[model samples]
Target: MTDLHRRNPYRLPVLLLIALSTVVGLSILWEFRLEAWVMHWLALPYDADFEDAERWRFVLTATGFSLISMLIPTIMLRRLIANTRSSYRRLKQAQAKTETLATYDSLSGLINRRIFMEMVRNQLGLKRPAAVMLIDLDHFKAVNDQHGHAAGDIVLVEIARRLEAIADDNGGVAVRLGGDEFCLLFLKFKHQTELGQIAEAAVFQLSAPLSSAVEPSALGATIGISRSWTDAQDASALLHCADTAMYRGKKDGRSTYNFYDSEYEKQRRAQADLELALRRAVEADEIVPFFQPIVALPSQEVVGFEVLARWPKPDGSTAAPADFIPVLERLGLIPAMTRSLIKQACRAANRWDDHLRLSMNVSAGMVTDALFPDQLLEQLRQEHFAFHRFEVEITEEALVGNLEVARQNLSKLHEHGITVALDDFGIGYSSLYHLTRLSIDKIKIDRSFFEPGQTDHLPMVEAILGMARSLKMQVTAEGVEEFHLPHLPSWLANSGCNYAQGYLYGRPKPASSLFCYTHSSFAQQAG
Candidate 1:
């Protein structure tokens, strides 16, 4: 207790105690003095009584003062003890609040990832089926890009609200697993199919656009499901399965759900092997370049080649882009593969006649990276290749996110003499809108238009071709396998498309085979 506190109004009790004790002691002393006087009077003559009374009064005053002094200290000590107790309670409450904030997510007020997963472990002893669903936002990056981070924050807040609504009253808990990922645990469910439905309902609630502080926002989710009783004999195994299911959801396209399966595990192992081999193939310099001839219409002479990426394993096998690209992208190893492919293709383009051009593929992630264009230019210069001799191909889906960054970066590349072509033009969101913003040189028509309905679909194809022509962009047709050359050439020419590349011309092949075969045929024609 400090001096200031000792003097606080709380000390009034001590002061009163001291005052009361003093009065009581004085009364007692007075009574005792009277008794002494009485005793003296009874024993002796009356004349000496007055003298004795004065002496007794002095003794009474001394005794009263001593009694008060003893009581004062005891009262003060009791007050000090109470203050210590009150302060201790307040300290404990503060500590408890601090711990709660540290372990729980502030936005949702749900248990944090650290504690939630621990709960999963503790559920194992109950032996009842419990499901863990990892819910991830489908287009969260798009939301972040379109609106600012503040707007994105609102979307997350709205998501938390929706989660609260969907929480089952019977059994289960919802937790925010940090940033756009949430976890739901269902204690009584043994089957994944049942769990998946519950997860989907929870995620689907966010499909309706959410209002944000900055702007109206929308996001979707993919759920990865794991069940304790169905998936594993133990907690760790169940969690691993759930984690695997989450990634599977990410792959099958977002805004969807998937359950982990033993079959998927086998395929996952195979996919892993292929990815490793692909990386090794990249390192061993086993990846080779192939080109599809892009001929100028009317002239019918090959003016350029789109540099095709090919990965041929040592076991006399080949992997298609579909088989290996998803893995590469997931691993963030596409950039390295892309770098290697670009240099090899650029070198080949340089070796060819100056007129022959090469178009390299660019992923969306690569295009927006500030360092990407510079590094590419550096590689081209290092390889002694001219930028004008190259065109870069990007799929519409690849350019889906981060439009502004992509537009600016791509514009820079275009200014530096690299032509841009949007590949698989019709397969992704709003190709025409993309074309309006992006400075593109060409559009490759999706091959689906070519199969089985060419006559019926002629008008749609004509419209697509016309759209490209209005933008002053060249059009290339893919999947021309076994088509009549005379018919395709005439029809495409009539529709304003000038380029065609598919198996009809040649499958992807080594440069040596290309040089030996296509060049020889051209020479024969010249002769």
Candidate 2:
């Protein structure tokens, strides 16, 4: 039983003692001249005959009624006091629970962001030697996605336990900063090397595979360490520095730790500014499609043009794809950008010869998306582009990333007469598996194999051509610059390379130049 329940037996005794005390005190007061004062005040006969039976009975009755009235109120007041005490105890418990809920994570039982920041501020004000380590679980979403959220929760709870243990060993505090992110605050650390050791331990401990994880290999962490005195002057700044370092660790391939560096902060700011600018540029349609001719081997007849993105700047210069393409992918703008490019490229291709086709690159994310093929078809239909005239160039990495999704998307494209070519073929792993299994129409040999004077790749190229011919799929040799032609064209054609494209034909140009280039004699002369 609770304390309140145990105290119930004392309630009645307490009430009885209070009543007895009141009665005794009243009797004492009456004996001490209080009765005489009361009788004189009321002008009552104090010296009246007490021996008379009728008068004695009247006085006895009044005394009995007075005692009864006093006892009743005393009993009520005692019960009231007991009730107030019980209520106060309950209130204290509830307040404690509320404070706990507010200051700590309900699942992990660790201090939350609010309490963590407050504690950090106190430590800083005291000028105590301290450090903060920010940890992010790598590929944590796969746990939720594949094993269900229940399993994900179990994994998170386990991680919190490990973090708490680490913090306890180091004389620090562990915090759940929400989701898969956690923080450790160390107040007793003496040097940067001590913080690094702790961070290394954190990465090693957190990266250990969990029983509840769907992909055990994916269970890992990236830790970023920041010292209070050197990294920042305040709690938020310290956290930001750690966060910056954490992302840097993730960028450097994860399962690692990074200490706060001023250079990383500068790069982070620059990337942020560029991301903002790229978002605006995409929304404004400043990034447009440029066409590079893809010619049939030997004949050199322009078969189609591969669409490349070119960002036209305000100063009449174009931004390089190397500068902006990665940013687009990071911002998740590639899908929208790809769709827009498709429509523009289709419109431009319609102005060229009817036989010429248009091909555009799709990122791994786009290929994995279940809705991308349908969306691409809808865009093509809106532009009055024939399915046969549209092609998609996907990298080998996309194929290996998720074979099932890639198969589904490629199947849909093939069903609609949309060509699928595996781009940058030789650089990826398991190239032959994709070629034999997937319903691919063509394979574009990566440019690396075609670098001038690179005779060592010639045998590899021949092997790829032989494999393509055996599989009854078309082959396109990329990076056919002037240095590699006219001998390269004849050699590739003899080796069964069905198509080629490079600067020798023409650099990627505006839509207006595509028609003239297709009809130009230079295209035929390259044959």
Candidate 3:
């Protein structure tokens, strides 16, 4: 212990008591002793009988001294009391302010997640009917991106005000559960329809334009509601159910609301399972690249292979790319998975004829990464693979929100002789616009146009081929799977298309299969 603390643990209280006693003693002595001293100085006994004039003088002098002594101490004591009360009030105010900071959101002036959870527990303890509405703001990031974070904060504050007003009308409480997410707890409600109406009103209120100063496009909310009896009785479970429903609403289309449904929960669990399996698959290297040949139409020469992801099961079956690719993209696992696949494919392709190129597809999320091009180049360097022997295939969706970043990254790759192909072309609304902006070396017409029963596919194909020719970009007709028909290959070759890829050429096969094909006479012919 420090010497100061060691001297006296209650040192402050002890000194305070001594000071109070000294003040009291001094006041008592001044009121009594000082007047007696005056009497002694005048050589008069304080209680002695005297003539009328002398008695008046003594009485007035004694009363004046007593009044003066009492007044001084009384004023000091009153001042001290007032200061103590004032200090106490100020301390209380500080404590209340601290509590407010702890329990409420400073930006929105609503209860924070901590307080919301506590309130949920309290309501659950009461065993009363209540519901939790989870609200997620749609396109909130776009506002932050386009206008700046200060504008986003203003939007959140205004949203909180509207939510608070609605919660008050419904006898509920509103909470800001961190960025762009909020919750409402309804303690009084009759039926599900009432909650639905309240949710609709909330959506409408939140979607209205804020002011003339800030013009953001379609800032809205998606609300998911869960009840005490039907969905969940506990706080965490209730929130989970509401979150599941909210996500479903978001996936279906934003700016709407959904009530808790068992199907959403099931899907949530299934997705969770798939995500776990995919993570394991990525870690265990079970997800590998299977190459499908892209052939020069009419010549039937294998120019390159489009690398596809295959997750092999123990039963010799494989999971479809459609089933797990979206999960990988959503979990931000695409870059890691893609990197692994690139390493494996590059090592395999490095042993193949140098004339053959490997085209690998990248996810939309991967294109947004500023360092992705450098990372891929570095991986190729580590594998001793030439940049010109590799190609990147990205769907039109990859160019949506990250056009500039994608352009920058793709340009870097193109500079290093890595070709960039706009995959799934003619499908997105802005494919033509993307072709003009991005560093696109080729365009792959979407396979959907060539599906069976697409009778008018010829016109669309002709238009795309004409555009590609005008731009001096190579065209690849995808899903030309009917090679048995002699006219299909001739039509594609005569239409000024450079390549075609689908089941008609060959299904995606393993690396070991390529070792034999590379040695065959057909491989020499394609070469």
Pairs clashing within candidate 3: none
Error of 3 at 105 (Å): 5.9
Clash count list over all predictions: 0, 0, 0
TM-score of 3: 0.63
Worst 10-residue lDDT window for candidate 1 reads: 516-525
Across residues 152-245, which tens digit of lDDT does each residue of candidate 3 receive?
8988988899999999998899999999999998876459889899999998988898863666988899999999878888988889999999
C-alpha lDDT values of all predictions: 0.75, 0.85, 0.84
Q: What is the lDDT of residue 310 in candidate 3?
A: 91
Winner of 1 and 3 under TM-score:
3
- Measured against the true structure, the TM-scores of the candidates, in listed sequence, are 0.54, 0.71, 0.63
> How many pairs in model 2 have backbone atoms within 3 A of each other, for residues 3 or more apart or on separate chains, i.e. clashes?
0
Alpha carbon deviation, residue 425, candidate 3 (Å): 8.5
Encode model 2's per-residue lDDT on 1-527: one tens digit a residue.
23543568676557666866666566655645477688989999887343456544655565577668876886786677778878999999999999999999988899999998998898888988668899999999888888888888898899999999999998889999999999998876558778888889988999887755344466899998888878897989999999999999999999999999999899889989889888988887778999988988777778888999999888898897998998898788998788778877888777777777898889998998899889999988899999999889998778767889889999999999999999999998888888877879999999999887788999999999998889999998889998876789899988888999999888998897644445544445455
Q: In model 1, which residue pairs have backbone atoms overlapping below 3 Å?
A: none
Model 1: residues >4 Å from true position, as ranges?
A: 1-76, 94-119, 133-168, 173-184, 189-224, 243-259, 265-286, 291-306, 314-316, 320-339, 345-378, 386-527
**Could you give the candidate ranking by lDDT, starting with the highest?**
2, 3, 1
